[model samples]
Target: MNTVTRAHLCEAVYQEVGLSRNESSALVESILAEICDELVAGHTVKISSFGTFSVREKGGRIGRNPKTGEEVPIAPRRVLSFRASHVLKDHINHAPASGDNDADGTR
Candidate 1:
């Protein structure tokens, strides 16, 4: 989802948990900042029911250009990966029970 939608959800969470909008926004910002910091530091972050973010090192390799088909050298780089937690994966793979349902439970 987009940032706006995420913000909206966070706002709802705050409302449910009895926090002000500003406090909720600050909480969201803090968590996001922590994720950014972890990625920047080349560390792996795993949220129990959400996902994981990891930095991987890539070795330099030769690749073929699509158009020219010429050999190109690719430099090594760091990459981040996210693996969904069991709860998140269950949501993704879950099917409705066919009573009354909505995508992503937005209903």
Candidate 2:
């Protein structure tokens, strides 16, 4: 399994867009910062063909402690969640599996 990082995104942008490494990094950072800022401001962000990001508020609840069989209170708080768009889901579902070749036998 592999995880994509900010550095990977920057490198991709630099290669595909012919931007300097620093500029690519800055662009990625700026876009992420804007998303974060909007979420922090209680706004939902929807990117076409990608997904939607929003904050959800969960109510406080009583949870049990398994070790001592004690009950504990869970605080209410906001959580960030993502719902992938149908376009993204379809793309992922139709994508080639790991180690599999494409239709043209290309990786």
Highest TM-score scorer: 2
**Per-residue accuracy of model 1 over 1-107 as CA lDDT, tens digit each:** 32346567676668677888888878888888999998999989988888988999999999999999999999999988888888998977886477344334441
Task: List where candidate 2 sits over 4 angstroms from the true fold.
Answer: 97-107
Candidate 1 lDDT score at position 23: 86
lDDT string, candidate 2, 1-107, tens digits: 55668987887788789889999999999999999999999899999999999999999999999999899999998999999999999988895666454333321
Q: Cα lDDT of model 1 overall? A: 0.81
Best by lDDT: 2
| C-alpha RMSD of candidate 2 | 3.8
In model 2, which range of ten residues has the least summed lDDT?
98-107
lDDT (Cα, 0-100) at 87 in candidate 2:
95
Q: What stretches of model 1 exceed 4 Å from their correct place?
A: 1-4, 96-107
